[model samples]
Target: MKRIILASAFLSCASLSITSTAAPMDFDFSGTFTNDNDVVLLDFSVASDSTVTIFSSSWLSPDEGNGFDPILAIWDSSGNLIEEQDDGEVVGSTESNGVTYNHGTWDSYFTQFLVAGSYQASITQYDNFAVSTSLADGFERNGNPNFTFDENFGGATQALFNGVWDDSDPRTGAWEFHILNVDTASGPGPAPAPVPAPATLALFGLGLAGLGWRNRSKKA
Candidate 1:
């Protein structure tokens, strides 16, 4: 009886330790340009209490045009700046590939781990330019010209847009921007979110082991 109790207690402690010592999971965000509109600002929500590590982005550009500048900004629940990427800071740029790039492609990417929860992404085009998109990929947005995120089909991953406009003047032409939530391709879904304190898992394991030993002794 004592041995059985001790063994059970040890197993419980082991489980606790295993749970507590677990490492923070890595995160990823990969998106294809679903539209050709230059995004000025994008917004969405992340499951609060998670770390967003990878944020890859890129946009298509008309030959020789500029200013998609691709700024990535993050705000807290109260709309405070938590992190900002390319906010007036240019990471890198490549010339247009004759694709007009109005609905830009994200061959360009940014990476960062974030504390999960309500967050936002905003991409923008400051000057006259064009990008590319995959609007032809089944979804439709007519008359409005601007495609807004469908909250029903959106959750952890999504594409958010600011708006789109066509310019009469080529130089002062219209610009577009987008913000999006990172999503995965297939399978069960997002892995368990990362916790701030990974060491807690070891502590849990130790505690469980102690408890099991005590219980076993009592039974004896």
Candidate 2:
């Protein structure tokens, strides 16, 4: 997987900042992955009990142009991995963006209803996952050695994945993480998202561990 690395004024590791916005607003963090298994970590919070949606769609259509095969995840303030979604059946067809990233099933999507609190989110490539339950430890593929992938698709030995899957080459590009339906208070109020701190950005401890699932956005 060759990812074209681009330079931007934006620091790779962003600081967590918050903003208020109007209805149907989106909060996102952008970065890049230099190698396989590279992951981006972001900090965010929900003001109250409500439903939140997050997805990575740039890799799908030419719209954003760079978001790659994103894997979305979240953890509690304690750093415990809560949930990680691989494929989400989001856009059924192309909308105003005239983009249908939902077709690849490559984009990550998921929604959860929860109480307001601080949380950490992560964005990763195809199969790269969090090595431990804690966010501080980083991802399994973050520091992976230069090797080759094998039949052990999503096993503990995944650190051995050299980027390429069975036939699909590994890739690099813009790394983006987004949160939808954010609020400024305990209810639905719009807010601006903050960038993460230079922490080089760095979550799946497990859950979406395999290559297959039912009713996902699409299939490889």
Candidate 3:
């Protein structure tokens, strides 16, 4: 009974040691914005085995030359720069008979690399005077291209995106943003627990035999 209890305790502790450290962390952001062509930046902590995804959505712009271009940068948990995409025009633009449209509902994923805890996302309108009219209609020069930009960093930290525009000026429009945090649950990978070797078992058996023999001699 005593040996059974000891073995059970050892197994329980080993299992607990493995299971206790198997928790998944997550973050998510989503939303829409109106005429404020500006930069949106986000920062998140990155673990050695962490994965991250960013989702972006926006209503189609009315202006013909206006399109949404987003740039992202990532830093490791230790404040080291890990990855960065610095293209004034990261998203490809589509045009139909001289009408241009940018990609919306964009998503980017990061994994299998070391990244810093901080991330920055910046957005800029391709054309200065473009405006969003509808989803299907490409950006057309309305009156003035006061594009809107908003952001949700999607982690423990929350940031508010605010840009200044002149309401009195017909060229400027209101910039509104909404950020949503999503679920972050990671499935365990194929890493299996290491089993004890035959050599270790043999050593344990020898130790047990020695202990038993010593106990018998003491009893005699």
Q: Which candidate leads in lDDT?
A: 2
- Candidate 2: residue 215 lDDT (0-100): 40
20-90: candidate 2 lDDT, tens digit per residue: 33232345445555555544555555656668776765555454544456667776667677777676646
Candidate 3 weakest ten by summed lDDT: 206-215
lDDT by residue (134-217, candidate 3, tens digit) is: 111112222332422222111102122222222211221211111112111111111111111211111111100000001111
Best by TM-score: 2
| Model 1 clash number | 52
User: Could you tally the backbone clashes for each prediction?
Assistant: 52, 18, 30
Q: Rate the local accuracy (lDDT) of all candidates.
A: 0.26, 0.47, 0.23
Error (Å) of candidate 1 at residue 159 is 29
Runs in model 3 lying further than 4 Å from the true structure: 1-22, 32-37, 55-67, 76-81, 86-112, 115-220
Tens digits of per-residue lDDT for model 1 on 16-96? 233322433222222222232333222233443444432222334443242222334443434344554432222444222
Candidate 1, residue 141: lDDT: 31
Task: Provide the global lDDT of candidate 2 against the true structure.
Answer: 0.47
